[model samples]
Target: MISTGEEVLHGDITDTNAAWLSRLFFEQGYALSRRTTVGDQLDGLAREIEHCSLTADIVVVNGGLGPTSDDLTAQAAAMAANTGLELSEHWVAEMEAKYARMGREMPETNLKQALLPQGAEILDNPVGTACGFVMRINRAIVLFTPGVPSEFKIMVQDQVLPYLKALFPSVVSQVCQRLYTFGLSESGISQTLSSLVVPEGVVIGYRSALPFIEVKVFAPQNCPNVSAFYRTIIEMLGDNVVGIGQPMLSEISGLLQENAMTVSVIEEFTGGALVNELHRDEACASLLKDGRFARDFAKTDKDLASLAEAHRRETNADVVLVVGGKRHEAVSVALAGKGAVWVQQVASKRQYSQSSYRTVIATLALDMLRRYLCGMPVFGHYESLSSLSSFSNERRTG
Candidate 1:
């Protein structure tokens, strides 16, 4: 793949198109062999296209297809293929019709978009003005696409992928399974699963994305022991496992709806991030009775428990969650329910940025509620955090 434009080459804009394409192709059993970035210079773009054509069976060229003066991909493609540019009268009419629908006249400069290399096949772009095209350069088939993410993605799905599948019929698809876990460091997760043996042609990998660690397994679709191997790893990890191919927030939301429970939240150290994360799920949002930012409350576990209970009574919710702490000190999470109150306090084992610290606290608070809902222990052990104190109380009735 050759990504073109000064913005992408100079890092002025993120190349999300490349990342999206890589994932898309991998999932379709066609992994990209190489990726290259070139500026808007015609000679450089032509050179890169010619270079990739010799090594790859297929090459995708992105960007430099707009109507502006900087758009030079069409010329570069023509140079690489040793052909002259020819105007596509059909695309010119399509552009004119599109502008007429919008109640405006098409600009003269837009005619440049209709210009294509000789003997190239036009790839229609339904969402934007920049049209895509396909041409052959030496041994490789080069496909050109616009830089707009929406248009590029749609064209790849509707046009490029089908063409590739027909071109390469014998490619075998691989199966991938993902497990999401929180409160465990990447090294700790690796050490815990180090003794397990994986079958041949199966690969296990770990990726740390902030407060959660993702474990991914890749194997052939016909692997017989993959399911059992996956279950064993989950059992070894125990309560740290939150979901499969889903985040904790989604898991918590499902539990809340299944149990028909409503909740109110009060936060301090994490600001309003706890509420924001909960509101992201529609089911959770509907069940959330109240969400507030509280700063004047006492930081003690007993006081936090009392505050949560009071809020629960005020909102008449099934549960109330409260978080409070001083910066760079121990943080506390309290859960108040109908007949019991639970609180846990922990301190960070290493220094973290303010945003990261807040994110950890917020995730910890959510995990506590999730555990209680699942009928498990509310306090969890984390490698980067140490428990300071815990409290639990069951109310009595006469």
Candidate 2:
């Protein structure tokens, strides 16, 4: 894959297109072997495209397909294929019709977008003005796409992927299983799973996406024992395995809805992030009885437990969760229910930025609620955090 643009090269904009394409192709059994980035210079872009075409069976060129001066991907592709650009009257008419519908006149610069390499196949862009095209350069088929993410993604799904599938009919699709876990470091997860022997033609990969780690198993669709291997990994990880094929937040939200339980939350130090995450899911949002952000709250477990119980009673919710802590100090999470209150106190083992620290606290608080909902031990253990204290008390009812 060749990613072209000065913005991407200078880190002015993130190349999310590359990440998306990499994952998409991997799932389709055509994992990208290499990624190259070039600036807006036509010569550099052409050289990279030519180099990639020789090595890769298919080369995807992203960016530099706009109508502006720096939008040189189409020209670079024509240069790399040793062909001149040809105007596509069909696309020009389409653009003029589209602009007419919008009650505007098409600009002359937009004609640049209608130009294509000689003998190239047009990939229609339904969302935007910049159309994609495919051309052959030496031993490889090269596909060029616009820089805009929405248009690029749509073309890939509607055109490029279908073309690739038809071109490579016999390629086997890969099988993948993703497991989400929190409270464990990537290295720790790797070491913990090291003893498990994977079957031939299957590989385990780990991605640490902060606050949570995603473990993936990639195998050929025909690979044997994949399901058993996945089950064994989940069992080994135990409760730390927050979810399979989803994140902990989504999993917890589903569980809440399944149990027909409503919850009230009171939080400090984490702002309203905990509540906001829960509310992101429409079903879970409906189950949230009350959400309050406390600017000042006592960090003691007793006080937190009391606050949670009071909130639960006030809102008449099935459960209440409380989070409070001082910056750079210990944090406490409390869960109150009909019969009991569970409280856990923890301190970070290493210093983290304020945002990261808040995320950690919020995750801990949510994990506590998950454990309570699942009937597991609420005082969970984490490798990166030290457990200060954990205790349970009977709820006082009047």
lDDT (C-alpha, whole model) for all candidates: 0.89, 0.88
Global local distance difference test of model 1: 0.89
lDDT by residue (tens digit), candidate 1, 33-128? 999899999999999999999999999999999999999999999999999999999999999999999999999999999999999998999888
Clashing pairs in 2: none
Ten-residue region with minimum lDDT total, candidate 1: 389-398
- Estimate TM-scores for all models: 0.95, 0.97
Q: After superposition, how far is residue 239 of candidate 1 from its true place, in Å?
A: 1.5
lDDT of 2 by residue, 208-307 (tens): 8879999999988978789899999999898899988888878988899889999888888788988888888888789999999886676467888888
Residue 14 of model 2: what lDDT? Answer: 95
